[model samples]
Each structure stands twice: as C-alpha cells, then as structure tokens.
Target chain A: MKLVNSTLAALRAVRVNKLRSALTMLGIVLGVSSVTVMMAVGGGASQRIQTEMRNLGANTIVLNSGALKSAGVSKGQGSRPSVTLADAQAIENEVPAVTATSPQHNFAGMQLIYGNANWSTLVTGTTPEYLTIRNWAVSRGRAFDREDVIQGSKVVVLGRTVAEQLFGNQSPVGQEIRVNRVPMTVIGELAAKGQSLAGVDTDDTAVIPISTALNRVVGRNPANPRAISGVIIKVRDGANMASAFSDIRQVVRERHGLLPAQEDDFHLINLTEVMRAKEDSARALGILLAAIASVSLLVGGIGIMNIMLVSVTERIREIGLRLAVGARRSDILGQFLVEATILSLIGGIAGVVLGLGGAVAVERYADLGVVLNGQLSLVAMAFAAGVGIFFGFYPAWKASLLQPVEALRSD
Target chain B: MALVAVSDLTKTYMLGQTAVPALRGISLAIDRGEFVAVMGSSGSGKSTLMNLLGCLDAPSSGTYHLAGQDVLRLSSNKLAAVRNTSVGFVFQQFNLLARATALENVELPMVYAGIGWRERTRRAREVLAQVGLSDREHHRPSQLSGGQQQRVAIARALVNQPLLLLADEPTGALDSVTSDEIMATLVRLNEGGLTVIVVTHDAEVARYARRVIHFKDGRVVSDDLNQNIRAAA
Candidate 1:
C-alpha cells in the first residue's frame, strides 16, 4: 500500500477518537517540556558560574595568612599575622611564572565621606596592577598612576556602588573623601559590575594605592615596618599556575624561617581549582535534573503505549477488514507507528517553544543569565521521537499479529 | 478448462479433544464463465466448502487447482497473490469497512494489491459506476440502503476485474424486492462473462443461476443444469 494513503487512513482512524488522541499526546508534551526546561535552567546556571569565574580573573590566585597555633589555641584567632609587602615582592622576584603580584589590605564597614554624604563600604589598599588582575575597569577619571603610588599621594578609586551612594548621579572625580579621618582624592570610579555568583556586591568597594594607604591613610605599625594583610598573584600563563604557587609557597616558607615538614603560615587560593569545584557541582546538578526529566519521558512513553493499545482495540474491526482486503501485517504496523510519530513531533515542536519562552521569562524576571541552547532542543526532539517509536512498536506489533477472522468477528 | 477444480477436499475441526469433519471427501469442478449456486440447509457444510473455494481457509486434505495453478501447494503469500489477482469475495454481512466511503470501500482490494492512489480511485469509481452507484460514491455503508450496500459490495467484488466472484448469501440481509435487485445485478454480471459462485439456502436465489449443486451431510447430493429455467429466460 502507498505510504501516504496509509498515513491518511491512520490519521482518519485517530480522528475517530479525538479526545483520546489528544490525551495521549499530552504525555509527550509534558515529557518534552520538562526535558527542555531542565536543560535550559542547568545550562544557564553553568554559564553564570563560568562568567563569575572569568570576572575573578582567570590567572589570578589569592593567598591569605593562616592563624598561628600555640598551646592548643590559635594566637591569631581574630587577627592573623599579616602578609607583608616584602612577601609580595619576594613572590614576584623569586617565582619565575609570577607575572604580577600585589599585596592587599582590606577593611570592611569603613565609612567614606564625599562632601558630607557618607556611605559605609569595603576599602582596599593595593597597587595599580590590582585593577587589571581583579578584572576591574575605571569608568570615569583615571586610575592612580605609578607616580602617585611612588610619591604616596592620597588618591582614591571609588567602586560604582560607593560612588553612586556617596554622590548620586554626579561624578566623584577630583572630589575629596575621608577614610578613617584621613583625607583622600577620588581620581577614578570603577564600572558597574553587578554581582558575583557567591552574592557579593562587586561594586561596593573602594581602591587606593598601597603606598598612600600605608603612609598617609592607615599608617603601618611602627614596630613591624612590613606588616600587611595578604597578597594576590597573577600567573604569566594558566599553565604555570601550579609551579608559581609552589615557588611562592617555598619563598614564603623560607622568608618566614619555617622548619622542614612544618605547615606554612599563609594559605593560597587557585582560581582554577575553585572553577573546577564549581563545574563539578554544576555537572552533578545537571545530571540530577536530566534524570528527573527522564522519568517524565518514561511516563509519557507509557501513556502513549497505553493509548495505542486502546486504539488497537477500538479499531480491531477496521484492522480485520484491512487484513481481509489484503493489507500486509507490516502495513498495519507502519500505520500505527506513523500515528505515534506524528503525535510526538507535534509535542516536540510545542515543547521547544515553551522551553525558550520559559528561559526568556526567567532571564527577564528572575534576573538569571540564561542561554537556550539549540542543540539541547534538537536532542529533546530526537529523544521524543525515539520514545514514541520505542513505545509505539509493541502495541502495533500486537495489532498486526491478530487473526483477521477473530478481529472481524469482534463487534 | 475449469477455473476451479477440487479433488477429495476434506476439512476437519478439533473442538477441544473431539474431531468434527466439516467437508467429507468433496470433489467439484467449476468451469469459466459459469454461475453456479451451492445450495444447502444450515449445518450442511456449504459455508465450509465456500470458505475453501474462496481461499479464506485451507482444506485438511485436497488437491485444488485455481486458474490452472495448484493452489493447494502454493505458499500463503502466493495464495494471497492468486486471491488478489483472480478471486473476488462478497460476504453475507457486506463486510464493508464502516468508516470508509463507498468508493474507498470498493478501492480496498486494489490498495492491498499496492495500486497507486490515483489508479485505485479511478478503478473504484469505474466499478461503482458499473454497479449503478455512481451517485452514492461518497456515502458510507450505514448511510446507504441495504440494496445499495450490497451493490457497493458487489462493486468492490468487481473492482479488480477478477476471474471469479465468490459471494456467500449476497441477499441474506435484504428484503424480497432488494434481494431481487441484487440477484438481477448478479445475473447481469455473470451474463457479462464473469464467473460467479454463490452459497445460499434460498431456492429463489438459486433459480437465478444456470447451474445448481445441492449439499447434504457434508457431501454434494446433486449437481444439475437448469435447462427449464434457461429456456424460460
């Protein structure tokens, strides 16, 4: 028999029971929709983590001093020994792969005053290289130059949030601000960087050259001339990160005069390691979502199989008449399979639309950066078709195997 | 040569553990262009013989030749081919696919024979017009009268232009007037040089045929040419 004619006949047969056919197709719709939605959400989250990782500077590693333990109690419980400027210089000179290093001292809840308008924010003291290594951009005015850092000039760079809060809609360039009763000039303002995946406000911090911070602002202790908070090291290339980290650790150990086999005082954070951990967690979440979505697909396949069985029973007389008139068993099987495929294809098309709409809605309303992948949609459509064929086969086969005489005898 | 030749045809059924013989060593020959009626009371095995002749069932033991080919030795697929190209069937209940229109119903056999849609439609319309149902081509069987449905069935039987027509109780469900119309249509078809075999208990239906065979106790008791009826015609 001609395939087109057979398909038309199958369509007519399905039309005889429109309600049942629609109900059967509902399973496919739900299955495809669930898979698409899950994939969209998971992919969106993965992209978000990757963007945050990029914002943290791909090659930068952060190192902080560890607490010193003495007599079963940490001596630096609330205040660990600071990583001095000497340590930062040592890492830059001794580690061959270390391209740039900046010693940083951060103080939270610091009050900033710009022309009587004050805002409490995070204050950080670092060199000009800190802006590039932290992926920070100067939107207005100019970042502190090498001359300002060398001359110990009191120039400050305001984060977008601090600038906006202290001087709403007005440029804070050349304005004077007081940090811990020390007057500073705002030479630049950081661009608006929204937020990190860890929910930290990237715009809510202020920057100043470390020399000015050490001499004119937060003066260094007279007793410990090199005292500092911590240091951030940027590797020349991503491939050299591990070796640079080992070299920096060895230098720090030697400078601190640590004994052999003793734990180091400072801790190092490799951005790549954090990225890998985040990727592993994201992958696990994606697999869990996919598994849950598979359950929905399985349920939908079962629904299709059940409806097809009922359809076979309802059309037994027609089947018998077709067989009597010379329809081969394969023809009957093909007819049912075509019906199932049509149902699933329609569902897949609808699911793609729904999934993309959902992604767009989440992006707009929930403030999530979502990317609706075309490849995932294609995979979902193919899977829906496969499910239809897989589950549609047995019932159609059973229908084909029925004895024509017995089927004809059925009312 | 005979269109259908049967020798020592036997058919038995097993009801659980008991054996029942439906046809007992029956032998018959039907020539080309012959309108033969097989007449018997209910349970006389006339239906069973019709089934075997129509290729709807196989005989337990027999040598049957259809169109000079040994049908008894043919495989199922070959038998289906022979049935498709050489034989047409009309059941007592009409056996029309209820959902299909009269034209589509007539086109079914050609569809199974893998004819293209355009050709099947053309041939089905031609045969429906031949049965004087050209105006009712789009009507389903339920929408048509009993006589019309039977005409549609007959049109389907003639659609493939088979060598033989096997009809079982063609007028069993129709009134006397409709039955007469159906019988007249059959007589005209047979007169047009198409071979036809009809199974009926009604002697009135049997009188339309030129030859009649009577069955009793799973065997043919009489086979005779209707010379008087032919003379009257």
Candidate 2:
C-alpha cells in the first residue's frame, strides 16, 4: 500500500536472491541488446542511404531521348533523338524549377590515341554544367567554360580512369589525344566518383564540348543537328520536383509539337525515387529486425515468472507471516511484482549500455556505419517493464491467493 | 458487548473425497484485556477455532462477532482488513523476515496498512522498545537468539495496536527458560489492557494464563479460571 515500503521491500528481496535475480535478468538484457543493436544497424543503413542519395543527385532529373515510335510500333532506347538542344533550352526557359540543364551526346567504346598507345572508353559531349549537375568536380586544370563550348574548341576533359589509361602517371592536361582520327587537347580531368549504384565505374569516360560531337562524330540523325542523347536538369532546392518534372515535360512536348494524342519521345528519370525506395526498404527491415528481436524479451519474462513462482513456493511461510500480520492480498502481489520489475529494469539499463557500445564498436571496427537511435533505448526499457508486468502478474497473483493458514503450515 | 462472541460454530473440510469435520458446535466468549489459553491435541480443532477467532478463516456455519462486527459473512478482503485492523497473531516459529532488521519487521504490518515510512518507523521503534528490544532494533532475525526472535515477532504483533493477540504454540520451539521470558512479556502486554490468547499443548505453559479452555475431539471438555495464575518470575 505504501510505495516506498514496497520499493524498499523489493530491493531487500532482490538483494537476498542476488545471483538468481541477476541470472533471470540476463535474458532480458540480451533481448534489449538485440533490439537496440538492430535499430542502430537500421539507423546506420539510413545514413548510408543518404550518402547514396547524395551520390545519385537527389535534385537532378534525367530526360533521356528515347522511346521512339514508328507507325505505333515503339523502337527501344536512343533509337530516336527527339530531345534536341533546343528542347533542353526550352526546359530551362519555360520550367520555373529548372535551375540548370545540360544537353549531352555520347559515343560509347571510342578509341583514344596518344602517341602509339591507345585506350578505348565512352566519349561524352556536354557543357560545363554537366559536371555540376552530376556532382563531379574537375580534379585539375579548370572546367570548360562558355568560350570553350560556344567557340567549338577541340578540347576534352578526361575522367580519372580514362586519364590514367591514356596518359599513365603523366598530367593529361595540355596534352593532345586523337579520338578516332580527330585530335583534341585535354584541358582538365574530372575527379573520381567511385562506383555508381549500378556498380558501374563512372570515371571510365571522357567529356568534350557538345558542339564538337555534333560537328565531328555521329553528326546527324532523323532529328537533325538539334538532337541530343539526353538532357540532365538540376532542380532548385525547395522546388516541387514532381511539378517541375511535369512542367519540363510539358515544355518539351510543346517544343517538339507533339499533340495530346501522342506520347513524348523522351522519358524522365527522377533519381530521388530510386533513393527513396532504398530508404523505405531499409526502414522496413529495421522494424522487422526489431520485432524479431523483441520476442526474446517475452522468453526473458517467462524466466522471471518461473523464478517468481518458485520463489512464491519457497517463501510460503514468509507469505503466511505477512498475511497473518495484516498484509492484504494486494500487498503480497505488489511485493512480488516490484521484485520482478526491479530485476528486468536492471537488465534494461545494462542492455542500453551494451547496445550503444556494440553500435560504436561495429561502426569503428567493422567499418560499417552505425547510428544511435536515442528513442530505442527508452523503448527497450519500457519494453522490459512491460515484460515485467505481463509475466510478473500471474506469479504475484498466485502468491496473493495463498491461504495464510496452509502457507504457515508449510516447512 | 464482549470483546468476542460466538454461537454455534462448525467447520468441515473436504480432503479429496473425504469430508473432515474439524470444529463442531463450539461457542465461547472472552472479555477485553483477558489472557486466555486454548488447549487441545493435534486434530482436536483448537487450531481451527484459533484461526476462526483470529479472522484468518471463516466457519462453515456460525454466527460470530468480534468487536461489534459480524465477521462470519465478511468477504476475504474485508476479513483481511479486520485481521489487519483488529487481530494480531504469533506463531510457534518466530516468522520474522530473515532479511529485515527488527525495526523493519515490526513496520511491515503498518506498511500493508498504508502507514507512511516516517510514522511507521516512529511507531515501530516505540513498539520494539515496548517489547524490550530497543537495543536490537537494527539486528536481523538471524542475528538474534531464538527467544529474541520470538520477542521481535511479538513486537511486530503489537505494532498495529490490535484488539486481540492470538498466539498459536508461541513457545513451542523455545526452552522453558526462554518460554517463561516470552510469557512474561505477554503478561506484561495483557496487564497494559491488550487481550492475549495463546494456544499451547504444554500444561506448564498454560499455567501462566488466567483462564484455560481445554478441547478434545472437536468439543470443549473443560473451561476453568485459575485463582493462582503462575507468574513468569
């Protein structure tokens, strides 16, 4: 009936059975640790997702020129080049959220010759904004400017991997390389971006002015000189991307004079959607792992109940004495319940410390990202208390229901 | 009204398929501040009657009153409350919580009665001193002698200021010297206006009671008031 008394009594009870109580709490400690660790892993995974999103450019959208249709029969990607340079310009001018747009044309498996040795890689042609839109920095020299792009200068920016292949340890800047019989000066080198989400080596390429590609190689198609391979657009921060996408599509559709009855010649790729799906699945996995880990706490609670029941049986005479001296049934129940709660609570606290230590250790030693979810420790504690309540009740109730006279009669 | 009233009490218990009758038509009354002893051999129903009188149990059929309340029809919870508020009990075993000090043991009944810690400690100290255990207030049951543990139990019983002290074979585990000391404490408590009833088989122990009721075969064989009640000294 008195809370302080019950707590003090519970403390004394736990102290009497110190080893047994600690052993019972070990299960609960494990349960809480599993939950905390799982959540931390989930949190770490979320951080990795953020980095992946950054790598993929969360605000960038790619409108690739493809999905060409002839007599209602659709040709595959890049078969038609309706996404011209003019359409890219129109998207920038008409779409309010379009911060920047870079029209690109690329020839895959192009041979580059420097002296007698030669290397083969993709050659992309684009303006300076291409590097900004793709989050790539120029490692040496400078990015191509408007003069280089507009003057149709025969200059190239080599990706790190391509530079290594063509020039070896030498600085590729100020050097000239022949791209299948057409000579170009290497003005800069792009930084390494490592592996992309598709596990492709993004650095194994080269960049030239778009004017050079249109004028020299892959000169013309059915869409004429204005046609490009694709347009990469950077949407401003805080802009509604979905509406920007629609606005860009509308501008392109109108620029190409496609009617409502016809599908546009290009498809838009919102990179954020892919990143979000990855994040969603990671979150779901976190919850699932935590749920799975929580089952062990119930088992731990069962351990508590088992010990409590044995305790009740062993302390029958004690119970009888308490009852004989004016303790009510609820008093007996409260005492036992308090004991169980204290046991599990100790486990919960230990588990929190263990989980945090494990998280840091995993992150540091395993070289994996680990995040600490502050709420999870609290949740695990509450969970431990819940286990105490759910499992402790029956045994306490059993103790309370004991007949004082019979209990006193027991040895 | 007398401190206790009983008319026509009977108790029957079922053990598996057998109906065992423990108490049959037993009725008795004792006044406030009386020191009485109930005596019988095992299975003679003196223990059963003690349980009923202490509010630890209810009779199968009876009209019983304690301190002006008809307790025969009271629910288990109310019966427990009655035991808490009005009746205190001592056992043959000292029944002290082995983990708790003497003061904490004495404070337990008041704990269940929802007494605050400060007041519980205050009154428990007062009662422990009354039982001549003031110096042993912080001693655990294991740290005390057998007679000292029994005194601590008595101190616990008196903590609630109950109307009756029902002791079942209170000195059964103690030697004669220690038993006399325990009886002397009970007599002193009785002299201070606390009603005390002891159940004992030893005639030497029963000699200290002012009135003795003897039971045989679930019936009272004799009820006698002794003029030369033996003093503990």
Candidate 3:
C-alpha cells in the first residue's frame, strides 16, 4: 500500500512540474536514440559487407599486376602489364585448389552507341569462364560461349546498368550496339550487382571475348600482346584461402620465371580477409558510439539527482508532516526513489519511440541501412531505470535522514 | 489509568559547544477523556515538552508511557507505528499538505498505517463528517479558511482513532471568533471521551480546557483544574 501511494504521489509531483520534468527527460531521450541509431547503422554496415562479399563469390581471390618502376618512379597496381591469358590457364591447370580462372583486360571510357542514344562505360574483355569466376548469372539470355572467344566473335554481354542506360525497359539481348565505333551484337544481360565496397556502381560495364578486344578493338601490344591487367580466381570449397593464395602465388611466380630473390610482379586480394577486417572495424565503431551516447545518460542521471535534492529541501515541511503522521524513514526514501525512477522510465519509453524514428530517418534520409530489434529497446529501458536508482540514492538518503522535529520547525 | 504518564522527563539541546536544557526534571499524568492545556512563553519549554509527549522527539533522560505502552523504549520504526496508531498531532501552522484535498489530508495517517484504500476512504470520510467538513472534502487546504483548514488538520489527527490528540497551538493562526469555534470543537470531542492536550501561551485558550498547566523555564509552575470551563458557553 505504501509503495502504491508513493508511486501515485511521485506521478503527481512530476505532473505538477511539467516544464522541468520534460527538460530533464530530454537528456535521456537523446542518449537512448543515438545509441539505438549507432547500433543499427553498425549492424547494417556489417550486413552489407557480408552481401558484397557473397557477390564477389565464395573463397574467391583477385590477382592484380603490381607496380612497375619507370625512371625510378613506380606506377601503381594494374598500371603495368604482368599477368596474361596464358598465366591464368597455367594457374588453373597446376594449382589443385584452383577451381576456375578468368584473365581480364579493361577498356575504360568506351562510348557505346545504340541508334541516337549513347553512353560512356567500361568494357571488360575475358573468356567465357569470367561469368563462372564472378558467380554472375545471365538474367535475360545466354552468356557468350568459348567458341565465340576462339572465333573472335563480335558478341557482348551488357551489365544491368549499361543495358538500362542504353535500352531503358527494352531488352538489349541480340541487339546491335556499337562499342568505340565497332558494332557488336549483345548476347545477354548480367543481373544487377548493386554497389561495391567503395560506393562505385558494379553494374555499369560490358563484357566481351578477350580475343575480339585484343585483336580487333585496341590492337595488340608489341611487348606482350596477350598481357592482361588482372585475373579473377575461384578456389575449391573447403580449401584454406591462405594456403590456396600462397600456392597460386607460387604457380604464377614460376610461370613468370621469377627468381626466388626477386619481388613478384603481382598482388593477391583475399575477399574473406577484407570482409573480416571490415566487420571488426564496424563492431569497434559501434562500441565507441554507444560509449559516447551513454555519457549523456549519466549526465541525465546527474540532472535528476540535482532536481531531487532541491525537491527534498523544498518539501522539508511535507517530509516532517509525513514523519509525524507515522511515516518511517524508509517510506520517505522510497517515495523519492519512485519519483526518480518514474521520470527516467517515462523518458526511456519516449526515447525508444524517438530512437526507432531516428533509425528510420537514417535509413531513408542518410541512405544507410538500419537494423533495430526488440532486445535493444528492452535493454535501453532497463538501463534507464537502473540509472535512476543509482543517481537518486543520495538525495533519497538525505531526505530519509532528516529529523521530524527539526524539519517541522523549519519555515 | 492515565492515557499519558511521564516521570522525571528531561531534554537538552546543543547550541554549538553549549548544552542548553529545554526541559528540566518534570513529571505529569493526564487521564483519558480530559482536556488539558499547557501554557508557556516562547522560551518556557512547553513546545519541547509537547514534542516529547507526541513521540516526535525522544527525551534526554526520561520514561514515557502512552496508553500502557513504553513509548521511549520502542525502536524508531516501532515508535513511528505507535505515533501513527496511538497519537495524532495538530501543528499551529495547520500542517496539512497544501496540494492535497481535505479528504486526502485526513487520510494521510491511515495511509501510513497500511490501511486499504476503500477502508481508508471510508474512515477518512467518517472523520471529515465529524469535523463538519463533509461538503468541503475535496477542497485543498489553500482553498479553505484558516478555521476550516484547522478542522481538516483535526480530522486528520482523529482519523486513526488515536488514544491521544496532541494539538500544539491548534488555534494560534485563527481569529478570536474562529479560535472559539475550534476550541468548541475540541471541547465537544473531549466530551465524546477523547483525550486532548493543547499547548499554547493563550490564557483565553487555556480556559476552555478542564485543567491548565503553566510552564516557566522548563518547569511546570502550576497545575490546577479550571473552576469554570468555557465549554459551557
């Protein structure tokens, strides 16, 4: 009965000081909402990384040409001609862990024209195995065949973005689109791959046979006509990525005839390792954001304590009157404690609402994915109540220690 | 047997490093159904003695028995319970909760007594009606006159059906007409077998009581029955 009365009394007191209560609750509201938003953003980022990694294909690695020194200055990766179509074939045949390989030569800034409409896009030339190496599916028609590559056929596979840019809603398959003034027949359209980790569009390019690109389009290089910029390799399932990486490196080095003391002209990128590092950083960022937000909750608790102390001093006569009417010291303590808890709990409930709204706002306006669950909200509420009790203790204790005679005597 | 019995009661106050005696060795007894008024000046120790008798403050060295229970020997919590069920205090300020309704103010003691809501409301209404404030039950203390607020405080004091009603200058804040009205109410309640003790320096207020005790320098100088009780008026 005492608890019930005290709670009611607390609620009444809060209602009486409307502006002060609302201002006090604002701190907690902001803290909880920010915490919720940070956790959601972190969860969303990690999830996106996982999907991007999946799109890159499981147990896949990319081998790009390392720097080449010219006049004592080094050109960056992919700037030198290192790996070739022959090296790709050798790695697949020699390494037991290697499942599929595709040597790629990129022709960027290629203007694609289709009857009055034209768009500038990248054109990647590779063998038929490129589709399999990338786990890319033909959404509209069939992918190019090995016979097409051997015959040096002028056939192309348009990406979802390229197809949409040139054809709008129309199907690009079997249509003729001139690439750099060379008319090529579109064989199929690749499925949309969305954005990459660097925020670049992945579906804004076209794929063609390497023979067609090297022999007819760009002409052959005098040093190594068959040299390619990079090779995409798919390792066998259940094989260790690190071991397969070293084995592929060894095979590439041997095929290139590099001595043991010489530096290799290629670099390997393991998608799994990149994904793990990205996830770790995301988790760390989440903890940092949560830590910063919780400081505001602590500040809010201190604000409540400050107000409760003032209230105790103001209601000295009321406390004395209660004591004279047979209120135990514990009852006085319990009453103030209940008041503080109710303030924070109500703030917490409001914060949960505000936090969910904030998460949605980030997802919509900030263009970041957000993930909010029931468990996070519940934990926030419980923590808010705990903060109330912890900070309200000193003031409630002070109120309880007051002497009835002295308190009643005070004006 | 007396409702209140005190033997050799003494209370001392600490004024920084000095020990000031508020109450010297004093002994008194007031039986049930008696209306007693203790009159004294500002530094006469009448208020300190009243505080001790109401169990609001413990005596420095004394024994106090209220309705056969040793009040000074009880634990703090037990003493609080005794104060709740055995004694009701009415302050000169009419110390009713300003924000609470007259009904709620009357129910405060019963609330502390752990009484259920329905029973508390019932008894609170019963006592408010006794104080002739049934129509003004929902009025807050600020909304009522000084006399009405005092009546509400008295109703609060009587709600737990205490063995003793300790009124410290119950009419000090009221005008002469209102004071008479409040004194008349106390006299009528005393006639109904309630033990009442009013502490005041007003000789006029003291005349309403069946017995008057005068205090000077923490010592009772006189204890005598009133020859002509003002309640007959």
Query: TM-score for every candidate vs. truth?
Result: 0.77, 0.69, 0.85
Task: Name the lDDT of candidate 2.
Answer: 0.83
Better of 2 and 3 by DockQ: 3
| lDDT ranking of the models | 3, 2, 1
Top candidate (TM-score) = 3
Listed per model, the TM-scores of chain A against the true chain A are: 0.83, 0.66, 0.83
lDDT tens digits by residue: candidate 3, A13-83: 78976876786576667666666776777767777777677778778888887788789788887656788
The DockQ scores of all candidates, in the order shown, are 0.28, 0.45, 0.63
What value does the lDDT take at residue A350 in candidate 2? 88
Per-residue CA lDDT of model 2 for A276-338, tens digit only, reads 888898788777867776676666556655665566567778887788777778777777778
RMSD of each: 5.3, 8.0, 3.9
The fnat of each candidate, in order, is 0.27, 0.75, 0.71
lDDT at position A312, candidate 2: 57
- Candidate 2 stretches with Cα past 4 Å from truth are A1-21, A46-50, A57-133, A136-292, A311-317, A333-346, A373-380, A407-411, B75-78, B114-116, B226-229
Tens digit of per-residue lDDT, candidate 2, span B1-233: 78988888998989999999999888898899899999999899988998889876668887899988998778877887888879988878878888889999999888878888899999999998888899999999989999999999998888889999999899999998999999999998999999999999998889999999999988899999977799867
The CAPRI-style docking tier of model 3 reads medium
Model 3 lDDT per residue over B148-216, tens place: 999999999999988899999998999999999899898888899999999998989999998999999
Clashing pairs in 3: none
Task: Return the clash pairs for model 1, or none.
Answer: none
